[model samples]
Target: MDKDFWLTKWASNRIGFHSTDVNPLLIEYWPALSPKGDEHVLVPLCGKSEDLVWLASKHQKVIGVELSEIAVRAFFAEHFYLPLVTHIDSSHVYYEFDELEIYQGDVFTAPLSGVDLIYDRAALVSIAPSQRYAYAQRLCSLLKPGGRILLITVDYVQDELAGPPFSVDAEQVQQLFPGMKTMLLCRQEADQHHPKIARQNLTRFADEVWLIEA
Candidate 1:
């Protein structure tokens, strides 16, 4: 997908994928992963998620990489935070808000490392299938040895609908991140009552959650 597609989505206020509440799945499944306080957590393609705020309170530092500066600023502004800002480079800006460190830049190129845990709620399912493997590689590379990921993906028949939340099955995930230890933490029918499903004409959808370790 073109980078501008997402930038335009933010520009035009078409981010239907963004949720109004912290994802319930994250809340229910995260503690089982056994987070040690004071570890670094990276959230890829983080879009001003309240999850970051929640995470900051628990972890030593919460790092998020996003492409939209608007989203980054709105995140702190909406929460009534005044961040200490710094320009990382031409492509990146850093905002230090409480324990949250949000970087506005390309997720693929961010100087991200030493990530003890990764929270990937929307990143995986939000891109084209052709990019999924590379995305997984980038995600895994950010971790230290034995680092873990809390991942969520969606699966559906391609012909049934188009998507930013594209269908990615178990086989596809394994192909993308070979040799990783993985456990299925949750699998259920996606909320069919979601109003967008009717508008998109989707026939079916399934949500899958995984705990992945390198």
Candidate 2:
């Protein structure tokens, strides 16, 4: 997807991908990773997700990278926060409640260091297929050794539809991070009866939760 594609989505409020609540899979598997105090967690392509707020409550520093300014603003606005804004290189930083910081720019172009954990729910699969490897390399580079990543991906037939939420099988993920210790945390078929899937005419969809240790 191009920058204009996402920018238009945010501009028109066409964000069906944005969940209203924290993801249940994250809640279920996060403790297994055993993140410690004040450790920084990175959220790539984070589109004003409520999960960041949930992580912040656990006393973890949350850093989210988003491409759209509108989505970034909506995150703080909807949460009733007025973030302390600053400019860092080509990106804009929005810090709020002393726990969360969102950077608005391309994730590859952003400067980041000291990331201890990664929470990837919709990020990896959202990118174009050709870009997934580059995205994974960038993500792996940000992590400190012994750090972990909680990655979520979808599996389905891609010929049926166009995607901002693309389909990525487990093998591709393993190939992306070749030497890392990757484990399949969970795999469950998504509820096809739901209105969301109905719109897409998706016959089958499955979610794969992965734990990556460096």
Candidate 3:
């Protein structure tokens, strides 16, 4: 998968991955991270996710990096937020509204740093496994020392389906972020009744939440 793929996905509204509601796991586990409430939170590959709104409520600043300009504008429009837009560079457009800021560009190239907490609800899983190492490296560079990540990942049989939402189990998570202190926070069995899993005919699907300290 590449930038054009995601840009096409957003332009075509083929966004089954986009969630309308705040993730329950985030609500339950974010507080355990014990955020200072003045910290800068980063949400990567954030496609107008409602989780960004929730994070903005809890933090002094919430920065999201998304590739789709369509998604970025939709976010502020949906929330009735009139953001001040600026072209940061050829690769990036910056949008700011109140406590929320979104960089509409490629995650790897976006100018990002000093992130206190990273909320990785769907970012990691969306990357092709071959590129996850690069993704992890870029994220680590953006994060401050002692920064924390509240990451949610899904695990399933890779051969069972072609995926943008790929199977990234505990071991792969460790491999992706070698030497980072990772603690598994929770695991929930994926609902077989859910249309995504049901159609794929996956026998085992589970979501794991992890707290990573850098």
Candidate 4:
């Protein structure tokens, strides 16, 4: 998958991954990071997520990078925020508001050198396997030394489903971020009652969360 894949997903409103509520898993695990309420946090591939609002409410500053201008605009609009927009570059635009800034462009092009925390709810699993190693590198590159990551991923038999929430098992997570101190925090079977899982026709699905320190 390339930029067009995601851009088209947004354009066509095909985002089954977009959660209208703050993910309960994030609420449960964020405090484990022991945030001091004054650290910059990066939310990658954020697609108008309510979690962005929740993070900013609890943290110092929240930065979100999204590929879709429509998603970014919708994020601000949905939050009732009137952002001061700037044209960062030809490929990117920036939106700034109280304690929140969104970079609208390809995530690889966003200038996230380092942040104190990263909340990777769907960012890693959304990418294809071929790009995962490089994606992990980029994630580490953007986090400070000793920075923390709260990552959530899905694990399932790939042949059973074609996915944006791709199957990223524990072993692959280790291979993806070899330099980090990683720990498995939780692993739960996907809810069969959930519409996405039902639609995917998956009988064996695992939803996992991990904590990583760089």
Give per-residue CA lDDT, model 3, range 79-181, as digits (tens): 9999999999898999999899999999988888788999999999999888998999888888898899999999889998788789899998888788899
lDDT by residue (1-214, candidate 2, tens digit) is 4778999999999998899999999999998789886889999989899998999888558999999999989899998988888877656564555789888889888777869999999999888988888989999999999999999998878887777678888888889999999999999886967653787787778889999999
lDDT of 4 by residue, 19-127 (tens): 8999999999998888878899999999899999999999879999999999999999987899999997898899999999999988887866679999999999888
Model 4 TM-score, 2 decimals: 0.95
Model 1 Cα lDDT, one tens digit per residue, 1-214: 4589899988898988788788889899988678988789999999989899878888998999999988898888899999999998999898887678988988888777678999999898887778887889898888889788999998788777777878888888777888898888999775657664666767767788999888
Q: Estimate the lDDT of model 2.
A: 0.87
- Cα distance off (Å), candidate 2, residue 78: 1.5
> Which has the greatest lDDT?
3
Q: Which stretches of candidate 1 lie over 4 Å from their true place?
A: none
TM of each candidate vs. truth? 0.94, 0.93, 0.97, 0.95
What ranges in model 2 sit over 4 Å off? 94-96, 191-203
Residue 34 displacement in candidate 1 (angstroms): 0.8
What root-mean-square deviation over C-alphas does model 1 reach?
1.5
> Each model's C-alpha lDDT?
0.85, 0.87, 0.91, 0.89
lDDT of 2 at 214: 94
